[model samples]
Target: MYQLAPNIDLLFTEAGDAPDRVRAAAAAGFNAVEMWGPTGKDIPALKEALEETGVQLTAQLAEPRMQFMIPPKDHAPFYTGLDAGVEVAQQLGCSRIVVGSGTGFGGRKRQDQLDELIEIFTRGVAHIEGSGITLVLEPVNIRVDHPGALLDRTSEAVYVAKGVNSPNFGILYDLYHSTVEGEDVAAELANAGDLVKYVQVADAPGRGEPGSGSIDWPARFADLRNSGYTGPIGLEYYPTIDSAKSVRRIQELVAGR
Candidate 1:
């Protein structure tokens, strides 16, 4: 079955509750939903929603929002959060979680910071290697969305994943960010190949629905499939129109249902 990962936080504003987002995605033909840190999630309610709506939690990002690709002085707290996220992932019946890099522009040497980041993620992989959950590091575009973010290039992200050197670690290649960063999506994705665990997208000009912006989504998605990415394609963009309208349009554009 084809899996579409809906961003509940961005999808069902009309429904108002987190569970309602899951219901909306399920009703709209999506089999999975991905969420940010488990901050406001109610486990029982989420479980009920999943059972009732038949939608699975495909992924959830870890909390506290520190840089994993650039080491900070207090990485233990971040590690603890990853450990907790693993337990949460186990609860949600998911085997993946996003590991975010911190804010842009640290007053430190680039190579030194990069080394520290590798060490932190290496330790993080060790902590969760026994578990089935995989930690995916995202490389945000410093040019448009985030300025001075450490992990910008696809090559750099691949390096980090290889440096971590565990099945539990990988990278998320978000198409919108890659477009903004001027990386050839097809080529970069082809290079990443099976190392990429998740993919997120939005239109280029407006960062809205896939077909409404400047991105040649059809070709890109074809490349994605051809490159052997069989995982859920994450609709992580902010809504340009009303949530329902935008989602419906995206469904027509991407899912053809």
Candidate 2:
């Protein structure tokens, strides 16, 4: 069965704080949960809640708010932040970290920026070589959410991951972003192949729960299965109703797939 990990960062906001959200997710029947960043959260309380609830911390953002991969000169700060991120992930027992290509550099050639990104991730992979941590690059949507984001297309992200050429480095196949970018989801998944390590989903048009928009959930999941991705599919959506109720349809959809 495909594990559905609710993104606590966006889903359970009504639960007050991080620990409460973690408890809420566990009470709602999720065995695993993901979040955006570790900073500003009560780490001890969050860890206690997870330990008590027996919920696995699946993934979190690496170097939140730092665009170290944007310019070659910024790599130093990125590594420093990555070291902190790795320590946080280890403390939370998470094995995956989400990375984003920062906005395109002004007046610099696109290929030049891409080459710098590849070089940055190659060094990052070497840093975490034996840490059992995988850094997954995410291509966010520029049209709807993130304007000027460098890696908006899945194909481009795949190319960068291929250039890195490390088992520790992979791409985050976010269905909502792909749909927003107007890419054929199945074809992109096939193109990504085994380089895809993480998945996140919300519906197109509105970043709501699965059934709230036009995404063909069954076909997408079928494509995911065909592509040999067996990792957790993150429900990183904003719920229009109660979070638990919003995800029921998706749970059924995933089960039927």
Candidate 3:
């Protein structure tokens, strides 16, 4: 069965603080949770909460903000940010970090940009070679969420990962973004194969809780299973109702699958 990880950054808002939200997720019976970035969070306190609640931090942003992965001039800051992220991940026991391909560079050849991405991640894989962590490259949707974002397709992400050619580098296959881009989730997952290290989900049209939208959850779940992606599938959606209530159906659906 697929393990479910609630995105505390988007859920459990009534809980008041990051640590409190961690506790809230545990109270809601989730053993795993994820967030956006650790820069502003109280790492020590969050660590305490995780230990107390016995919850695992599954994944988080590689940097506090989006970092440009295309242009060679932007690599220095990206590396520094990734290093900092690794330190925080060590404290939180998180094994995966989400990374985005920043907006496309104006006037740059598409292949040139892709080459730069490959080179950057190649060096990145070496930087964190023995850190017991994997940097998960995420493709954002340009249509609704991130306009002009480079690497908005799963195929492109897979291509980058293949270029990196390291076990420590992988792609974060977010179902919501894939749906928004109008890509077939099953086919993408199949094509991506083992290069996908993490998965996130939200129903399309409204980015709301599962039942509030039209995504065929069971079929997607099947696709994930067939793809051999045995990682935590993050619940990264806004709650239309009570946060706990929003996840109930999804939890049941995942469990049944």
Candidate 4:
């Protein structure tokens, strides 16, 4: 069975700020949680709460998210931002940091842009070497959530990961985004294979909890298992109902109970 880490940014907000959410999730029986940007958050308080609750921090996003395809493409700030993110992750005992390919610039060949990303993160892996943290590149859906984003397909992210080609670098396979983009779960998982280092999930038709949308969780769950991914599944979704009640179906499915 797989472990489920609730995205505290969206899942347990009813509990309070990030620190309090950790306590709430722990009280509710979850042993792990994922969060977004570490900037502007009370790092000391959040760190205290995580230690207190024994709740593992699965991942956090790199700060000042870069729009790489934008003009001039100065990557200095992005590298600094990632370094700062790595510091925060180290403080919190988090193992993974998520990164994204922001909106694409027009008129550039898609291949060139993809290659550019390869260079960006290749340096990112080198820049953060010895941190013992894995950089997980995420491919979000352009169809619904992210319009004009350069990297919207898992295969493309896998390509970037291959280009980076480091033991500590891989792709984050988001189940909801892949489904929204109409990619077959089994095929993409097969395409990604072991390079998929992290995963997140939400239901399609309405990015809600497992039972609230049309996604066949059991089928995808089986496909995910067969694909040989044994990492924790981050429950990254908006709760249409109470947060605690929202996770029941997914908790059951991932637990295979």
The candidate that wins on lDDT is 4
Which of 2 and 4 is ahead in lDDT? 4
C-alpha lDDT of all candidate models, in order = 0.78, 0.88, 0.89, 0.93
Q: What TM-score goes with each of the models?
A: 0.92, 0.95, 0.96, 0.98
In the range 1-257, model 4's lDDT, one tens digit per residue, is 88789999998899999999999889888999999998778999999999999999999998788999999888899999988999999999999999999999997999999999999999999999999899999999999999999999999999999999999999999999999999999999999999999999999978999988999888999999999999988999999999988887788888776
- Alpha-carbon runs more than 4 Å astray in model 4: none
Q: Give the per-residue lDDT of model 3 (tens digit) for 130-167.
A: 88889999998999999988889999999999999988
State the lDDT of candidate 1 residue by residue for 1-257, as single tens digits.
Answer: 24768788787767768888788778777778888778887877877888887787878888778854443356778878888888878877877888866754467776666666678788888887788988898888887778867778887788778878887788898888889889988789888878898888788866787767888766777778778888877778888777667766656656533
lDDT of 2 by residue, 67-184 (tens): 6444345567778878888988888899999988888877788788788789889998898778889999999999999998888999889989999999989999999999999999
**Which of candidates 1 and 3 reaches a greater TM-score?**
3
Q: After superposition, how far is residue 234 of candidate 1 from its true place, in Å?
A: 1.1
- TM-score of model number 1: 0.92
Give the runs in model 1 whose Cα sits over 4 Å from its true position: 68-72, 104-107, 255-257
State in Å the error of residue 112, model 2: 1.5
